[model samples]
Target: MDPAVLREDMVDGLESATKDVLQDEAVAVAMRDVPRHEFFDDERLAYADREHEVLGTRVLSPRTVARVLQALALEDDDSVLIVGAGVGYTAAVVAELVGATNVHAVDISRPIVIEARQNLERAGYDGVLVDCRDGAQGFPEYAPFDRILLEAAAVEPPRAVLEQLSADGRLVFPRGSQRQRLEAISATGDRTRFEAVSFAPLLVDGEQSGTLERNRMAREDREHAVRRAESRRGWEQDWIEWEHSVSSR
Candidate 1:
């Protein structure tokens, strides 16, 4: 299979399907520049009709990749932190969008990290850092990133990741359990806000701490009960306050 042809097809498909969805010329160019076939090991399947699933863990469809790149809104000068950087395919594509010098790809699997390094290098993205670490725990050593993308899904956006974003920085990932929704989180002042959309759930390893899981479930139930109580409080005082503020304005 010719990688060039496969890459062109994927780029052309993205160009046609996402022309309106993704209005960035740089992202379009980056899609065209990066060869997707190089990321897959199956030569015959590289250009096959099926979506490319890396290491049987993470799936990277052309459309999904395009959407992620578009969501990132990467600038040439911006630095990006990519979690769940499987085999560096998404990382390589992202590196193209944000310049190799400004991209760092992190993955938990050591061998996969090595594969990612090779893939990036093979795709002429040698400058991109492909590091091995627990991606759930954002790389604090390089905190305050201009942008962050988690290729895998999480029950909720990791607190560490939210803290790592620079002011106004964007973070995209899937949030939810049985029903995952795509979310775009942005850091504003000392707080982070999120907008929910939809995407496929990312493949992530289960938590190792049983105690943490039990505690998290308990906290979630408590929070849910509190929210229900608060909603039931009937906007009485809050509604009056809001009305007064609106009238004054």
Candidate 2:
């Protein structure tokens, strides 16, 4: 069982007229070359065309990856950012198309980010930057990406992500909360919609896995909350204090 041949067969099924999920030759080659097994404990499942759970994130299946890359229509040397870099497989494939250094990815879950980084490194795409951050915010430090892909679904494109796109850049995402569809939007606001798809909702601060604290809070804020909770004036406030309610009445 050669992994290379498995990759070839896997992609072949995707390209066959019956499924026809793959059309972009570049993406097909990249999928063939990137060692997808590096991201999985069982190499057999790596080429099975099914989703795997990695650190609470669902890795994109190959057909989904193909559909995304086709929508992106990437060109060489194009800078790309991937939100929700689960296991880093998609980012690695993208690295093949546009060089590893040109790829950047961010994830809201720190554990997932770490997993993605490790997987990318093992897959020899160490040049790709994987960071822990809110996906909706995007990797703005590398602002103005030539292309952006949000693997998670959202009701609409996050405004901050849109802001990070280069004027000529385009973003691909699954839109909607319950009924998601693939969509691409240009920086100038032009949009294109494609086939229906399903993806987990994008997570925000405080909602990320393993977090129990409120979002956007400083250490000072947490300390203040603790102090307030321990103090008396009852440690809790009503919608209207008794005195204030009487005065207003």
Error of 2 at 70 (Å): 0.9
> Model 2 over residues 1-249: C-alpha lDDT tens digits?
999999999999999999999988899999999999999999999999888787767888889989988999899999999988889999999999999999999987778888888989998999999998877688878998999999888877778889999989999999887798999999999999999998877766435543332223234434644454346364344321221122122
User: What's the C-alpha lDDT at position 178 in model 1?
Assistant: 54
The all-Cα superposition gives candidate 2 an RMSD in Å to the true structure of 8.4
Please give the CA lDDT of all the candidate structures. 0.66, 0.83
Instruction: Write one digit per residue (lDDT tens) for candidate 1, span 1-249.
Output: 467777677566656655444456777677777876677767556544346545544556666676777777787778899887776877877777767878887875666788888888887999998887766678888788999998866677667778999987989786665565566777863323243434434322222211122113334634543454455555543321111121122
Q: Which stretches of candidate 2 lie over 4 Å from their true place?
A: 209-249
The residue-level lDDT of candidate 1 at 223 comes to: 57
Clashing pairs in 1: 153-202
Supply the global lDDT for candidate 1: 0.66
Which numbered prediction scores highest in lDDT against the true structure? Answer: 2
